[model samples]
Target: MKKWKIILLLAGVAVVALQITNPARTNPPVLHDLAATNPPPAEITALLRAACYDCHSHETKWPWYARIAPSSWLVVSDVNEGREHFNFSEWPTDPELVVKRLDRINEVLDYKEMPPKKYTLLHPEARLTEAQRKFIMDWADAAGKKTEATAPPK
Candidate 1:
Protein backbone atom coordinates (compact mmCIF):
# COMPACT_ATOMS: atom_id res chain seq x y z
CA MET A 1 0.00 0.00 0.00
CA LYS A 2 2.84 2.41 0.79
CA LYS A 3 4.53 1.66 -2.57
CA TRP A 4 1.26 2.27 -4.38
CA LYS A 5 0.82 5.56 -2.61
CA ILE A 6 4.28 6.69 -3.63
CA ILE A 7 3.58 5.79 -7.28
CA LEU A 8 0.31 7.73 -7.19
CA LEU A 9 2.03 10.76 -5.75
CA LEU A 10 4.71 10.65 -8.44
CA ALA A 11 2.07 10.37 -11.15
CA GLY A 12 0.24 13.39 -9.82
CA VAL A 13 3.44 15.44 -9.75
CA ALA A 14 4.24 14.49 -13.35
CA VAL A 15 0.85 15.66 -14.55
CA VAL A 16 1.09 18.94 -12.69
CA ALA A 17 4.60 19.53 -13.90
CA LEU A 18 3.73 19.04 -17.56
CA GLN A 19 0.75 21.37 -17.35
CA ILE A 20 2.73 24.11 -15.66
CA THR A 21 5.82 23.98 -17.86
CA ASN A 22 4.13 23.65 -21.27
CA PRO A 23 7.40 23.99 -23.08
CA ALA A 24 5.72 23.66 -26.45
CA ARG A 25 4.60 27.27 -25.94
CA THR A 26 8.16 28.40 -26.53
CA ASN A 27 9.16 29.73 -29.95
CA PRO A 28 12.56 29.73 -31.61
CA PRO A 29 14.47 32.82 -32.58
CA VAL A 30 14.52 34.20 -36.11
CA LEU A 31 17.45 33.92 -38.54
CA HIS A 32 18.19 37.14 -40.32
CA ASP A 33 19.45 37.42 -43.87
CA LEU A 34 23.13 38.30 -43.61
CA ALA A 35 23.97 38.61 -47.25
CA ALA A 36 25.46 42.06 -46.79
CA THR A 37 28.05 40.68 -44.37
CA ASN A 38 29.24 38.03 -46.79
CA PRO A 39 27.17 35.23 -45.37
CA PRO A 40 28.22 31.68 -46.12
CA PRO A 41 27.32 30.08 -49.42
CA ALA A 42 24.37 27.72 -49.72
CA GLU A 43 26.38 24.57 -49.01
CA ILE A 44 27.96 25.94 -45.87
CA THR A 45 24.70 27.48 -44.78
CA ALA A 46 23.01 24.12 -45.10
CA LEU A 47 25.75 22.45 -43.11
CA LEU A 48 25.61 25.11 -40.42
CA ARG A 49 21.84 24.92 -40.20
CA ALA A 50 22.17 21.21 -39.57
CA ALA A 51 25.13 21.16 -37.21
CA CYS A 52 25.44 24.58 -35.63
CA TYR A 53 22.20 26.59 -35.88
CA ASP A 54 20.34 24.84 -33.07
CA CYS A 55 22.65 26.26 -30.43
CA HIS A 56 24.75 28.98 -32.01
CA SER A 57 22.49 31.03 -34.24
CA HIS A 58 19.34 33.13 -34.19
CA GLU A 59 17.44 30.10 -35.39
CA THR A 60 16.86 27.26 -32.93
CA LYS A 61 14.27 24.63 -33.72
CA TRP A 62 13.37 22.65 -30.65
CA PRO A 63 12.21 19.07 -30.87
CA TRP A 64 8.97 17.69 -29.41
CA TYR A 65 10.55 15.83 -26.49
CA ALA A 66 12.90 18.76 -25.96
CA ARG A 67 9.83 20.61 -24.62
CA ILE A 68 9.69 18.31 -21.60
CA ALA A 69 10.76 19.74 -18.19
CA PRO A 70 14.35 18.95 -17.28
CA SER A 71 15.21 18.41 -20.93
CA SER A 72 13.81 21.82 -21.92
CA TRP A 73 15.94 23.56 -19.34
CA LEU A 74 19.04 21.79 -20.56
CA VAL A 75 18.36 22.67 -24.19
CA VAL A 76 17.53 26.28 -23.36
CA SER A 77 20.68 26.65 -21.28
CA ASP A 78 22.90 25.19 -23.97
CA VAL A 79 21.52 27.55 -26.60
CA ASN A 80 21.97 30.46 -24.22
CA GLU A 81 25.57 29.50 -23.52
CA GLY A 82 26.32 28.95 -27.17
CA ARG A 83 24.97 32.37 -28.13
CA GLU A 84 27.14 33.97 -25.47
CA HIS A 85 30.19 32.35 -27.04
CA PHE A 86 29.44 33.65 -30.54
CA ASN A 87 26.23 34.66 -32.20
CA PHE A 88 26.47 34.38 -35.97
CA SER A 89 23.70 36.92 -36.40
CA GLU A 90 26.05 39.54 -35.02
CA TRP A 91 29.52 38.32 -36.05
CA PRO A 92 31.94 41.18 -36.70
CA THR A 93 34.18 41.51 -39.71
CA ASP A 94 36.63 43.36 -37.46
CA PRO A 95 39.85 41.62 -36.55
CA GLU A 96 39.05 41.12 -32.86
CA LEU A 97 35.79 39.32 -33.46
CA VAL A 98 37.29 37.50 -36.42
CA VAL A 99 40.17 36.22 -34.35
CA LYS A 100 37.90 34.98 -31.58
CA ARG A 101 35.60 33.37 -34.11
CA LEU A 102 38.55 31.67 -35.77
CA ASP A 103 39.86 30.39 -32.47
CA ARG A 104 36.50 29.04 -31.31
CA ILE A 105 35.80 27.49 -34.69
CA ASN A 106 38.96 25.46 -34.45
CA GLU A 107 38.43 24.53 -30.81
CA VAL A 108 34.87 23.36 -31.32
CA LEU A 109 35.51 21.64 -34.63
CA ASP A 110 38.74 19.94 -33.58
CA TYR A 111 37.16 18.66 -30.38
CA LYS A 112 33.83 17.82 -32.04
CA GLU A 113 32.19 19.56 -29.14
CA MET A 114 30.07 22.31 -30.68
CA PRO A 115 26.89 20.44 -31.46
CA PRO A 116 26.86 18.34 -28.31
CA LYS A 117 26.11 14.65 -28.82
CA LYS A 118 22.91 15.17 -26.91
CA TYR A 119 21.72 17.32 -29.80
CA THR A 120 22.77 14.89 -32.51
CA LEU A 121 21.06 12.02 -30.74
CA LEU A 122 17.76 13.42 -31.91
CA HIS A 123 19.15 15.14 -34.99
CA PRO A 124 21.35 12.53 -36.60
CA GLU A 125 21.89 14.71 -39.66
CA ALA A 126 23.43 17.33 -37.41
CA ARG A 127 26.35 14.97 -36.83
CA LEU A 128 29.38 16.33 -38.60
CA THR A 129 30.94 14.21 -41.28
CA GLU A 130 34.65 14.17 -42.27
CA ALA A 131 33.86 16.23 -45.34
CA GLN A 132 32.00 18.81 -43.32
CA ARG A 133 34.90 19.10 -40.88
CA LYS A 134 37.29 19.66 -43.76
CA PHE A 135 35.09 22.38 -45.21
CA ILE A 136 34.87 24.23 -41.90
CA MET A 137 38.61 23.84 -41.29
CA ASP A 138 39.41 25.18 -44.72
CA TRP A 139 37.30 28.25 -44.06
CA ALA A 140 38.78 28.76 -40.62
CA ASP A 141 42.29 28.44 -42.02
CA ALA A 142 41.56 31.19 -44.53
CA ALA A 143 40.11 33.50 -41.87
CA GLY A 144 42.94 32.80 -39.44
CA LYS A 145 45.48 33.47 -42.14
CA LYS A 146 43.84 36.76 -43.11
CA THR A 147 44.00 37.98 -39.52
CA GLU A 148 47.52 36.62 -38.84
CA ALA A 149 49.45 39.76 -39.82
CA THR A 150 47.80 41.92 -37.13
CA ALA A 151 47.10 39.04 -34.75
CA PRO A 152 49.25 38.83 -31.61
CA PRO A 153 52.08 36.33 -31.85
CA LYS A 154 51.39 32.89 -30.38
Candidate 2:
Protein backbone atom coordinates (compact mmCIF):
# COMPACT_ATOMS: atom_id res chain seq x y z
CA MET A 1 0.00 0.00 0.00
CA LYS A 2 2.79 2.43 0.82
CA LYS A 3 4.52 1.62 -2.51
CA TRP A 4 1.30 2.26 -4.43
CA LYS A 5 0.88 5.61 -2.70
CA ILE A 6 4.39 6.67 -3.74
CA ILE A 7 3.72 5.66 -7.35
CA LEU A 8 0.50 7.66 -7.46
CA LEU A 9 2.19 10.73 -5.99
CA LEU A 10 4.96 10.51 -8.61
CA ALA A 11 2.39 10.16 -11.40
CA GLY A 12 0.56 13.23 -10.18
CA VAL A 13 3.76 15.25 -10.11
CA ALA A 14 4.65 14.15 -13.64
CA VAL A 15 1.28 15.30 -14.91
CA VAL A 16 1.66 18.66 -13.20
CA ALA A 17 5.12 19.11 -14.67
CA LEU A 18 3.86 18.29 -18.13
CA GLN A 19 1.56 21.31 -18.03
CA ILE A 20 4.54 23.62 -18.24
CA THR A 21 5.17 22.39 -21.77
CA ASN A 22 1.68 22.92 -23.11
CA PRO A 23 1.65 24.32 -26.63
CA ALA A 24 0.34 27.79 -27.29
CA ARG A 25 -3.22 27.95 -28.51
CA THR A 26 -3.83 30.97 -30.66
CA ASN A 27 -6.67 32.37 -32.74
CA PRO A 28 -4.88 34.59 -35.16
CA PRO A 29 -6.67 37.48 -36.82
CA VAL A 30 -9.11 36.51 -39.55
CA LEU A 31 -7.55 37.90 -42.70
CA HIS A 32 -10.16 36.54 -45.09
CA ASP A 33 -12.91 34.51 -43.51
CA LEU A 34 -14.78 32.30 -46.03
CA ALA A 35 -18.20 33.56 -45.11
CA ALA A 36 -17.14 37.21 -45.23
CA THR A 37 -15.56 36.88 -48.66
CA ASN A 38 -18.05 34.56 -50.39
CA PRO A 39 -21.02 34.01 -48.19
CA PRO A 40 -22.86 30.69 -48.12
CA PRO A 41 -26.56 30.49 -47.37
CA ALA A 42 -27.42 31.23 -43.74
CA GLU A 43 -28.03 27.60 -42.74
CA ILE A 44 -24.89 26.34 -44.44
CA THR A 45 -22.88 29.10 -42.87
CA ALA A 46 -24.23 28.19 -39.43
CA LEU A 47 -23.48 24.53 -39.99
CA LEU A 48 -19.94 25.27 -41.04
CA ARG A 49 -19.42 27.56 -38.12
CA ALA A 50 -20.64 24.98 -35.65
CA ALA A 51 -19.18 21.80 -37.12
CA CYS A 52 -15.99 23.03 -38.80
CA TYR A 53 -14.74 26.27 -37.33
CA ASP A 54 -12.92 25.15 -34.20
CA CYS A 55 -10.24 23.17 -35.97
CA HIS A 56 -10.49 24.43 -39.55
CA SER A 57 -10.53 28.18 -38.91
CA HIS A 58 -8.66 30.80 -36.95
CA GLU A 59 -11.70 31.33 -34.78
CA THR A 60 -11.06 28.38 -32.43
CA LYS A 61 -13.01 28.38 -29.22
CA TRP A 62 -10.45 26.71 -27.01
CA PRO A 63 -12.17 24.34 -24.61
CA TRP A 64 -11.23 23.95 -20.95
CA TYR A 65 -9.41 20.69 -21.74
CA ALA A 66 -7.28 22.55 -24.28
CA ARG A 67 -5.60 24.31 -21.35
CA ILE A 68 -4.40 21.03 -19.82
CA ALA A 69 -1.39 18.94 -20.86
CA PRO A 70 -1.67 15.80 -23.04
CA SER A 71 -5.16 16.63 -24.25
CA SER A 72 -3.99 20.14 -25.04
CA TRP A 73 -1.24 18.71 -27.20
CA LEU A 74 -3.74 16.66 -29.19
CA VAL A 75 -6.19 19.55 -29.51
CA VAL A 76 -3.56 22.06 -30.59
CA SER A 77 -1.98 19.61 -33.03
CA ASP A 78 -5.34 18.83 -34.64
CA VAL A 79 -6.22 22.50 -35.03
CA ASN A 80 -2.82 23.24 -36.56
CA GLU A 81 -3.10 20.34 -38.97
CA GLY A 82 -6.68 21.19 -39.91
CA ARG A 83 -5.78 24.81 -40.63
CA GLU A 84 -2.76 23.75 -42.60
CA HIS A 85 -4.84 21.50 -44.80
CA PHE A 86 -7.80 23.88 -45.33
CA ASN A 87 -8.30 27.14 -43.51
CA PHE A 88 -11.66 28.83 -43.88
CA SER A 89 -10.20 31.88 -42.15
CA GLU A 90 -7.47 32.21 -44.76
CA TRP A 91 -9.51 31.26 -47.81
CA PRO A 92 -7.82 31.51 -51.19
CA THR A 93 -8.91 34.28 -53.51
CA ASP A 94 -8.03 32.51 -56.75
CA PRO A 95 -11.11 31.06 -58.43
CA GLU A 96 -9.46 27.80 -59.39
CA LEU A 97 -8.03 27.29 -55.95
CA VAL A 98 -11.37 28.08 -54.39
CA VAL A 99 -13.01 25.53 -56.67
CA LYS A 100 -10.44 22.94 -55.73
CA ARG A 101 -11.03 23.54 -52.04
CA LEU A 102 -14.77 23.34 -52.48
CA ASP A 103 -14.38 20.05 -54.32
CA ARG A 104 -12.21 18.72 -51.57
CA ILE A 105 -14.80 19.71 -49.02
CA ASN A 106 -17.45 17.88 -50.99
CA GLU A 107 -15.30 14.79 -51.29
CA VAL A 108 -14.66 14.70 -47.57
CA LEU A 109 -18.32 15.16 -46.81
CA ASP A 110 -19.25 12.48 -49.30
CA TYR A 111 -16.83 10.10 -47.59
CA LYS A 112 -18.17 11.08 -44.19
CA GLU A 113 -14.59 11.83 -43.29
CA MET A 114 -14.86 15.22 -41.75
CA PRO A 115 -15.72 16.68 -38.38
CA PRO A 116 -13.62 13.67 -37.47
CA LYS A 117 -14.93 11.18 -34.97
CA LYS A 118 -12.39 12.19 -32.33
CA TYR A 119 -13.51 15.78 -32.56
CA THR A 120 -17.22 15.02 -32.58
CA LEU A 121 -16.80 12.69 -29.59
CA LEU A 122 -15.67 15.63 -27.52
CA HIS A 123 -17.66 18.39 -29.18
CA PRO A 124 -21.04 16.77 -29.59
CA GLU A 125 -22.39 20.01 -31.03
CA ALA A 126 -20.08 19.56 -33.98
CA ARG A 127 -21.71 16.29 -34.93
CA LEU A 128 -23.66 16.62 -38.20
CA THR A 129 -26.84 14.73 -38.96
CA GLU A 130 -27.16 13.04 -42.35
CA ALA A 131 -29.38 15.90 -43.53
CA GLN A 132 -26.89 18.50 -42.36
CA ARG A 133 -24.05 16.68 -44.04
CA LYS A 134 -26.04 16.44 -47.27
CA PHE A 135 -26.90 20.11 -47.07
CA ILE A 136 -23.24 21.09 -46.72
CA MET A 137 -22.17 18.71 -49.46
CA ASP A 138 -24.76 20.16 -51.82
CA TRP A 139 -23.66 23.68 -50.99
CA ALA A 140 -20.04 22.75 -51.60
CA ASP A 141 -20.89 21.21 -54.97
CA ALA A 142 -22.80 24.29 -56.05
CA ALA A 143 -20.05 26.59 -54.86
CA GLY A 144 -17.44 24.55 -56.69
CA LYS A 145 -19.40 24.75 -59.94
CA LYS A 146 -19.88 28.48 -59.54
CA THR A 147 -16.20 29.05 -58.89
CA GLU A 148 -15.17 26.71 -61.71
CA ALA A 149 -17.25 28.72 -64.13
CA THR A 150 -15.28 31.84 -63.21
CA ALA A 151 -11.87 30.15 -63.24
CA PRO A 152 -9.53 31.22 -66.04
CA PRO A 153 -8.97 28.74 -68.86
CA LYS A 154 -5.74 26.75 -68.64
Candidate 3:
Protein backbone atom coordinates (compact mmCIF):
# COMPACT_ATOMS: atom_id res chain seq x y z
CA MET A 1 0.00 0.00 0.00
CA LYS A 2 2.80 2.43 0.89
CA LYS A 3 4.65 1.67 -2.35
CA TRP A 4 1.47 2.23 -4.38
CA LYS A 5 0.96 5.60 -2.67
CA ILE A 6 4.48 6.73 -3.59
CA ILE A 7 3.98 5.70 -7.21
CA LEU A 8 0.67 7.57 -7.43
CA LEU A 9 2.24 10.69 -5.94
CA LEU A 10 5.05 10.61 -8.47
CA ALA A 11 2.55 10.20 -11.33
CA GLY A 12 0.57 13.17 -10.04
CA VAL A 13 3.75 15.27 -9.90
CA ALA A 14 4.61 14.29 -13.48
CA VAL A 15 1.15 15.33 -14.68
CA VAL A 16 1.53 18.73 -13.03
CA ALA A 17 4.93 19.25 -14.60
CA LEU A 18 3.51 18.31 -18.02
CA GLN A 19 1.21 21.34 -17.91
CA ILE A 20 4.17 23.66 -18.37
CA THR A 21 4.72 22.27 -21.89
CA ASN A 22 1.18 23.00 -23.11
CA PRO A 23 1.04 24.61 -26.54
CA ALA A 24 -0.16 28.18 -27.05
CA ARG A 25 -3.73 28.24 -28.29
CA THR A 26 -4.22 31.84 -29.15
CA ASN A 27 -6.69 33.94 -31.18
CA PRO A 28 -4.41 36.38 -32.87
CA PRO A 29 -5.67 39.60 -34.45
CA VAL A 30 -7.52 38.74 -37.64
CA LEU A 31 -6.24 40.51 -40.73
CA HIS A 32 -8.81 39.86 -43.47
CA ASP A 33 -11.90 38.42 -41.86
CA LEU A 34 -14.28 36.64 -44.25
CA ALA A 35 -17.35 38.39 -42.91
CA ALA A 36 -15.76 41.79 -43.32
CA THR A 37 -14.66 41.14 -46.89
CA ASN A 38 -17.71 39.40 -48.35
CA PRO A 39 -20.51 38.94 -45.89
CA PRO A 40 -22.72 35.88 -46.21
CA PRO A 41 -26.43 35.80 -45.41
CA ALA A 42 -27.09 36.40 -41.73
CA GLU A 43 -28.38 32.89 -41.13
CA ILE A 44 -25.40 31.35 -42.89
CA THR A 45 -23.09 33.57 -40.86
CA ALA A 46 -24.77 32.45 -37.64
CA LEU A 47 -24.60 28.82 -38.62
CA LEU A 48 -20.92 29.12 -39.47
CA ARG A 49 -20.24 30.96 -36.24
CA ALA A 50 -21.93 28.31 -34.12
CA ALA A 51 -20.79 25.22 -35.99
CA CYS A 52 -17.50 26.01 -37.67
CA TYR A 53 -15.79 29.10 -36.26
CA ASP A 54 -14.37 27.49 -33.15
CA CYS A 55 -11.81 25.58 -35.16
CA HIS A 56 -12.01 27.19 -38.60
CA SER A 57 -11.65 30.85 -37.69
CA HIS A 58 -9.56 33.12 -35.51
CA GLU A 59 -12.57 33.54 -33.24
CA THR A 60 -12.06 30.29 -31.35
CA LYS A 61 -13.74 30.38 -27.95
CA TRP A 62 -11.42 28.26 -25.92
CA PRO A 63 -13.24 26.26 -23.28
CA TRP A 64 -11.80 25.54 -19.82
CA TYR A 65 -10.78 22.02 -20.84
CA ALA A 66 -8.69 23.55 -23.60
CA ARG A 67 -6.44 25.17 -21.02
CA ILE A 68 -5.45 21.89 -19.30
CA ALA A 69 -2.45 19.73 -20.27
CA PRO A 70 -3.12 16.70 -22.49
CA SER A 71 -6.44 18.06 -23.72
CA SER A 72 -4.74 21.38 -24.39
CA TRP A 73 -2.21 19.70 -26.64
CA LEU A 74 -4.95 17.89 -28.57
CA VAL A 75 -7.12 20.99 -28.79
CA VAL A 76 -4.27 23.16 -30.02
CA SER A 77 -3.16 20.54 -32.52
CA ASP A 78 -6.68 20.17 -33.87
CA VAL A 79 -7.07 23.92 -34.16
CA ASN A 80 -3.79 24.19 -36.04
CA GLU A 81 -4.80 21.44 -38.42
CA GLY A 82 -8.23 22.97 -38.89
CA ARG A 83 -6.74 26.36 -39.70
CA GLU A 84 -4.24 24.87 -42.08
CA HIS A 85 -7.02 23.23 -44.05
CA PHE A 86 -9.42 26.19 -43.93
CA ASN A 87 -9.10 29.48 -42.13
CA PHE A 88 -11.92 31.97 -42.64
CA SER A 89 -9.85 34.56 -40.81
CA GLU A 90 -7.28 34.73 -43.57
CA TRP A 91 -9.77 33.96 -46.32
CA PRO A 92 -8.23 34.37 -49.71
CA THR A 93 -9.35 37.23 -51.94
CA ASP A 94 -8.23 35.29 -54.97
CA PRO A 95 -11.24 33.91 -56.78
CA GLU A 96 -9.55 30.61 -57.62
CA LEU A 97 -8.66 29.96 -54.02
CA VAL A 98 -12.14 30.95 -52.91
CA VAL A 99 -13.67 28.49 -55.35
CA LYS A 100 -11.31 25.79 -54.16
CA ARG A 101 -12.21 26.42 -50.56
CA LEU A 102 -15.91 26.47 -51.34
CA ASP A 103 -15.62 23.11 -53.11
CA ARG A 104 -13.71 21.66 -50.16
CA ILE A 105 -16.38 22.97 -47.77
CA ASN A 106 -19.12 21.36 -49.81
CA GLU A 107 -17.21 18.09 -50.00
CA VAL A 108 -16.65 17.96 -46.26
CA LEU A 109 -20.25 18.84 -45.49
CA ASP A 110 -21.61 16.27 -47.92
CA TYR A 111 -19.49 13.57 -46.31
CA LYS A 112 -20.62 14.63 -42.82
CA GLU A 113 -17.00 14.88 -41.79
CA MET A 114 -16.69 18.30 -40.28
CA PRO A 115 -17.02 19.46 -36.69
CA PRO A 116 -15.40 16.13 -35.86
CA LYS A 117 -17.36 13.81 -33.59
CA LYS A 118 -15.11 14.50 -30.63
CA TYR A 119 -15.73 18.22 -30.97
CA THR A 120 -19.52 17.95 -31.31
CA LEU A 121 -19.63 15.61 -28.30
CA LEU A 122 -18.43 18.45 -26.09
CA HIS A 123 -19.96 21.33 -28.07
CA PRO A 124 -23.49 20.50 -28.99
CA GLU A 125 -23.97 23.87 -30.63
CA ALA A 126 -21.39 22.83 -33.18
CA ARG A 127 -23.68 20.10 -34.39
CA LEU A 128 -25.51 21.05 -37.60
CA THR A 129 -29.08 20.25 -38.33
CA GLU A 130 -29.87 18.59 -41.64
CA ALA A 131 -31.38 21.84 -42.85
CA GLN A 132 -28.29 23.76 -41.76
CA ARG A 133 -26.10 21.33 -43.62
CA LYS A 134 -28.16 21.71 -46.77
CA PHE A 135 -28.08 25.48 -46.51
CA ILE A 136 -24.30 25.48 -46.11
CA MET A 137 -23.84 23.08 -48.99
CA ASP A 138 -26.16 25.04 -51.24
CA TRP A 139 -24.39 28.24 -50.34
CA ALA A 140 -21.04 26.72 -51.13
CA ASP A 141 -22.22 25.45 -54.49
CA ALA A 142 -23.69 28.82 -55.41
CA ALA A 143 -20.60 30.66 -54.25
CA GLY A 144 -18.35 28.31 -56.16
CA LYS A 145 -20.38 28.91 -59.31
CA LYS A 146 -20.14 32.65 -58.87
CA THR A 147 -16.39 32.47 -58.32
CA GLU A 148 -15.92 30.31 -61.37
CA ALA A 149 -17.91 32.74 -63.48
CA THR A 150 -15.66 35.59 -62.45
CA ALA A 151 -12.43 33.62 -62.66
CA PRO A 152 -10.10 34.63 -65.51
CA PRO A 153 -9.44 31.87 -67.97
CA LYS A 154 -5.86 30.61 -68.12
Worst 10 residues of 1 by lDDT: 29-38
* Superposition error at 87 for model 2 (Å): 0.1
Clashing pairs in 2: none
Question: lDDT of candidate 1 vs native?
Answer: 0.72
lDDT of 1 by residue, 67-151 (tens): 7766776777777778777777656656666767777887888888867887788889998888898797777767667676666
Question: What does the lDDT read for residue 142 in candidate 2?
Answer: 87
Ranking by lDDT: 2, 3, 1
For lDDT, candidate 2 versus 3, the one ahead is 2
Q: Which stretches of candidate 2 lie over 4 Å from their true place?
A: 151-154
Evaluated against the true structure, the overall lDDT of model 2 is 0.91
Clashing pairs in 1: none
Error of 2 at 12 (Å): 2.0
Kindly list the per-residue Cα lDDT of model 3 for residues 1-154, writing each as its tens digit.
Answer: 6999999999999999999988998897787877764578999999888888889888999988788899899999999889888899998888888888888889998999997899899999889988999999998898889878888887
Residue-level lDDT tens digits of model 2 in 66-121: 99999999999999999999999999888877888888988898899998999899
Instruction: Write down the lDDT of every candidate, Cα atoms only.
Output: 0.72, 0.91, 0.88
Give the per-residue Cα lDDT of candidate 1 at 24: 40
The TM-score between candidate 1 and the true structure equals: 0.75
